[model samples]
Target chain A: MTHHTASAEELEALARHARWLVLSTVADAGAGHIGGPLSQMDLLLALYFNHLRIDPSDPHRDDRDRFVLSKGHTAIGLYTVLALRGYFDPAELATFDHGDSRLQGHPDMRMLPGIDASTGSLGQGLSVAVGMALGARLQQRDFHTWVLLGDGEIEEGMVWEAAYAASRYGLDNVTAIVDRNGLQQYGWPAGASDRFDRRDPWAGKDVGAIFRGFGWDVIDIDGHDHAEIDRALETACGARGSAGRPTVILAETVKGKGVSFTEGTYRWHNGIATADQLAAARAELGQPETVGVAR
Target chain B: MIAQRQVWGETLVELGASDDRIVVVDGDLANSTKADLFAAAHPERFVEVGIAEQNMVGIAFGLSTLGYRPWLSTFGVFLTHRALDPIRMLVSQTGAAVRIAGAYSGLLNGRSGKTHQDVADLAIMRTMPGMTVLAPADEHEMRAAVRWAADHDGPLYLRIARDAVAPVFDIDTTWEDWAPRMLRDGGDITVVSTGVQTSRCVDAVRLLADRGIDARHIHVPMLKPLDEDRLAGLLGERVVTVEEHTMIGGLGGLVAEIVAARRSTQTVTRLGLADGWSESGPDAFLLDKYGLSASRIADRIVGVHSRPVGTPGV
Candidate 1:
């Protein structure tokens, strides 16, 4: 099946629309994460709209490329992207996090289409992605596997364990995108104690160097820039399965992007958005003031 | 007596010959777990994932999604204790068809001490949703269980012992309906057992017969999805459970729960280790120390049998 590759300009517009959907989805649920979803909005938009070779109608096709959201707390972002990409009806976004809803608090592959794996527990999706890459090689298929991880999620040792295995197996068909958003759920607040002086846990640590040390081809880029995201995805796909090395793209971003009050703040990492906050966010994204839920 | 792990390795190699989807993912204990035989036969499909058990399970889950039957071979403790989160999330929650062959199960791996031994694998694996837990009685049953798991479509956990023991069932014995098999039929008392300890229970039953105490022997291979109706029919007035695992949640706990749910007046005497760790020693010494030897098991049954009716045995 042929796929339409959206241009950089189109992807930018989609990202803006996705940001509004994410904030409104969380607002409708009264319980969801916002900061991480906004942080990884452009990255997911660029991949779903331009790179991933997937058919929304045939989500489980054998040869389709696989994508796993490692940082599954931000599933609202992925659900919005999947709905916009036509994997399911966009009106179903209102039922997210509700009882009997297919859109669970975390991604459940069994309950929803287009979810390659059920992932909520951090530090495990990369390993599953590595296995998918190996399966592609064993089955002699050309499909690629991509996994998105959070910066704080990297603190899990299992992530590094999967990193070593992907490198050891020479799985070039798999690519890892780390959302280096520089904020976790619990960051240092203003003027509490000297011990809590830093904003994030990895304030001064070099994430790209760490992935490079794990024998991956590291590509650093601005996560919110559609052009940079498009370029990094191109490079990652170009080196697929032939370079004999897995590639990791470290995309630097804010905790919450595209919103003046929420950007770069951990307070919005996971919380209910009041009507006032939702209206402000929608107004900033150039969306209509009707913010009960996204259509 | 042939080692169960050896039978597992040989059976895996045979399965790989006919099914190209059979892949072995070992966690650096291929030789100890006897997965090396499959590696030697199908080197291309063998994945040496080093000593990472969690990642090994995650990889198997990934492969299972793409129609590949991946078997994860590792020590039982690491599989149950260290990699439980991955198994719960990646395999059980999703119902992935990943085979987890847990080697060196039970207290029989005495040389490795309590740290390496796994005495509660059944308690853990059986409780997980959508997991098929099995513990074969001997080499013959191990072969059958391995072949069954190869064709079954779901998450499965096979508990393999470290040492070889006597076979309780014949080579042609097949698991029918995933039920508990009756090795001996008697009327005085019923003795239920699972895993490698069932063989000892068989010998203990013989000894009980010699002592004029007729004891029925029921061997359970499949712990989860147990044939509860069949097992309830086989239970007698007095029941005793024996296993190499802990006393709390192994065969003993299972039998006790079944008996309690029925509200039957029959007494259940649980025989296994207490709520603590055992020292490193030979299999015989450890089994004897834990009241699991054939003679010791026979003695314990005799004590429970001699008790008056409606009186529980501690």
Candidate 2:
């Protein structure tokens, strides 16, 4: 729960900072998918601050790792990470979705820095990441690619398509993390369909087995737990193409993790942050004590 | 009528031969999609993502970002509808300079029914910011469009009609610019045409000339980023827009907006599909039924010429 290693402390601070960034940016506008962003903050924080070898100042630097937020509707999470990591001045976060602001509802790679690909439509980001991984191998660039997917987005057939190809090519340099929040927009993922009686379809279907069939090393872990995410990423770092497998990190997380009203509820997938709601969210996230806001 | 898909495939092969970075990615329907030519010529650069249009588009975006000129081919219906998420996200969002070739465009796929016919592809694609749409009039124009797309920056969606259409222009004529080309010029009236209907417009021009009427023909290859300034300067006011697409949000609508904005003394007439589901028939039969063929367009020109000079309808 507490940080000891400098790298660990630095990463934890970045994750905490990303949390504050999302809270303040979206809160200022009085709207945003505060829940989804809050849920994925820790994962993005860990990737940018610890796992990925990227320079914020040199975002387009050749040989740098690529990260794509395929769940683009939750761009607040990515904006938070980008701003906190200094990809752009934190002041730019104030202009999120405003007229003339490059910070759109989804990732717009052309208009902003530190964006590998523009992704707002769900279930496409991972496939693009696969190509990035393939291109890296062809060019002999040794960089890894990471894709963040939403639990609801998994329902899209394209996710499986990319998964199959990634395994087919033995793309060990590529890693996919599912923000398994259990709830999508309409209802609980399990209740969305009458086909299954289980609470979690991901488990019964053997997600690992499916990936293994396509020759992928699948690992499931707690998304909020930094130590586990770090270890899994480290293991992926050692994989070789000859090994005939890619890597998947199935991260289990609450839909609105850290917030009381929105947590575990589908209604908050895209809930707005009102003035009172922002205060309540800040108190729950321990925002002020962790990272100071400029205002 | 030659299928534009053939031209797209052939031009891609030519691009592949000279440019190593020219790559083709197709959905599972490679044979029907007509990307097999590029596959056979450059096996290393061609990829087939089995039945996954979303993944196909996404991979193309990845390839484009890595300095490769990727040509993604798929059925128009699936490419525009099923892959909308990727098309909007990966292509529009990232601003990837990828070229997307959609075969079986419009109702060219006769027997496939509603699900397969992409009646609204142009309308949908044009709505996306920074997307360049090209519906080449015939094989000659199709080849030129593909060649231009390879060198052009930003995302491009190419709608290739399936029906076999006659070549409207000779390849040796040398059309180099990305802007709309003036096939035949006259001050009396400017007939704006796009895609499959350009061939009809050519025929209409000849018919009007026979009737002692001078009708100008302007063939637009690129739909988005409309060349309004040039169009307004040349057209002045007299314009009739024609297309084998819906009158709503198609070529007709685009030209009408420009002509209206400029308010040049010439009256505007539109000939396109009516606001409803199109009746099933052979491609030519459908064009004829919708008054999109040469005879139908010529009739529209005559009707416009008959109108009083002082009367310009809003």
Q: For model 2, how does the per-residue alpha-carbon lDDT over B182-203 read when each residue is reduced to its tens digit?
A: 8898867788888877887899
lDDT of 1 by residue, B144-257 (tens): 999888889999999998799999878986766678988889999999999999999989999999999988899899989887778988999999999989888878888888
Compare the candidates by lDDT and give the number of the best one: 1
The residue ranges of model 2 lying beyond 4 angstroms of the native Cα positions read: A1-21, A83-105, A168-170, A189-215, A256-290, B1-3, B110-114, B186-189, B236-238, B303-314
Error of 1 at B285 (Å): 1.2
TM-score of 2: 0.86
Question: Each candidate's interface RMSD, rounded to one decimal?
Answer: 0.5, 1.2
Error of 1 at A7 (Å): 2.5
Evaluate residue B101 in candidate 1 and report its C-alpha lDDT on the 0 to 100 scale: 91
